[model samples]
Structures are given as structure tokens and as C-alpha cells.
Target: MRLRVEFTTEPFDLDEAPAHAVVAREVIQSADLDAVDVGPFGNTAEGHADAVLAAVDALLRDSLGAGATRISLQVNVVAEGHK
Candidate 1:
């Protein structure tokens, strides 16, 4: 199964990236996922279910440990025909 995950770690910083945001980005970028898009307000990654789920686990743990007060996320199963 293919999965797509969209997430954000809160305690927003306009001047610079927060520690939690940085950690979240690092986790997603390093994970065995594809179609990763990282932005100031949000981030998304797509890959097989296992890879996406593993990344989600790491992202939550690392970002929270790095001082994220809140995290918003959504996971969806991508249809085979969809991109």
C-alpha cells in the first residue's frame, strides 16, 4: 500500500526554523520515502505504507523531544491509480 503523510510541528517561528521543525524536516528527509515537500507551514511525504509509518513515528518522537508543543498530521492511503 502507498501512503501520504502531511504534518506540521507547532510553536511557529517566522524569523527562523524552530528546533522541532528542523528535527521534523530531518526525519522526513532521511526516511525511505519519496515525494517529500518541506515548507515553513507544512510538510508532506509519500511512499510505501511501512516507510511512511516509520517516518511518522520518528518524526513525532524526535520533534516532540526537540520541543514541539503541538503537532498536526494526517495520513492517507493513496489509491493505486492516483499519483
Candidate 2:
């Protein structure tokens, strides 16, 4: 199934936000999931959702450790057998 994961947070400056973006991409990659794209929105990331919940959990832990104030994530997955 295909999924889309979006992450938003505060304390992600333009310069430092890239670091967080990289972290997110790495998480998805580590999970053996395809990262369609990854970028920052003030302090948010919007793109492929290969690992869904697992990726989100890891992202939260990693991002928070990186000094993020607030982190919000949304995952949309395509159900099986639904084409």
C-alpha cells in the first residue's frame, strides 16, 4: 500500500530544519521504505509515508531529541485489496 506522512513542528529554523528533514528521510530509508520526497515547512515535513506509524514514532523521538518543541504527524495509508 502507498501512504503519505506529514510532520509539522516548531523550533525548526530554516537553517536547522534541513537536519530534521534528513533525520526523517533516514528513518524511512532505514525501515526499507521508499522516501518519495522530504522537505521542511517552517518546521514540518510532507511526503511519502512508507513506514507509517513506526516511522512517525521514530521521527518523534529523533526530532524531539533534536530540540523540537512541538511535533505533529499524520499518516494516510491505502488499504489492501482496494487497488
Candidate 3:
């Protein structure tokens, strides 16, 4: 199975996002999973469900360690369809 995920962390300041966001972004990008897109509001990646879930877990831990009081995440399971 494949997945798409969006992540947001707070204390959220639209103008200047917290350091935890940056750390979380790096964690996701560094994962060996497929990278579709990434941005301040959210990110999108596709790969094995296990790998994606692992990456998400790691990201969460790192973000919290970096001082993220709260996080918002949206995950979607995508079917392999012709693009």
C-alpha cells in the first residue's frame, strides 16, 4: 500500500515556523521513502506502508523533542493507479 501525509506542528507561527517543523521536515525528507512534495503546511510521500509509518513515528518523536507542543497530521492511503 501507498500513503500521503500532511504534518503541522505548534506552537504554529505562520510567519516564522518553529525549529521542530524544520527538524521534522528533514526527518521525512531523509527517510528512504518516495517524496512527492513538501512545504510549510504539509508534505506528501508515497512508499511501503511500513516504511512510511516508521518515518512518521520518528518524525513525531524528533518534533516533540524539539519542543513541539502539538501536531496535526493527515494521512491517506492511496491505490496504485496509472499517472
At residue 32, what lDDT does model 1 achieve? Answer: 94
Model 1 TM-score on a 0 to 1 scale: 0.96
Model with the higher lDDT, candidate 2 or 3: 3
What is model 3's C-alpha RMSD? 1.8
| lDDT (Cα atoms) of all candidates against the true structure | 0.95, 0.59, 0.81
Backbone clash pairs in model 1 (N, Cα, C under 3 Å; residues 3+ apart or in different chains), count: 0
Measured against the true structure, the TM-scores of the candidates, in listed sequence, are 0.96, 0.61, 0.84
Compute the lDDT of residue 27 as modeled in candidate 2: 70
1 against 2, candidate with superior TM-score: 1
Q: Candidate 3, 68: how far from true, in Å?
A: 0.6
Candidate 2: clashing pairs of residues: none
Task: Using TM-score, rank the candidates from best to worst.
Answer: 1, 3, 2
| Candidate 3 lDDT tens digits, 1-83 | 77777777788778986899888888888887885577777767777788889988998999999999998888888787611
Worst 10 residues of 2 by lDDT: 42-51
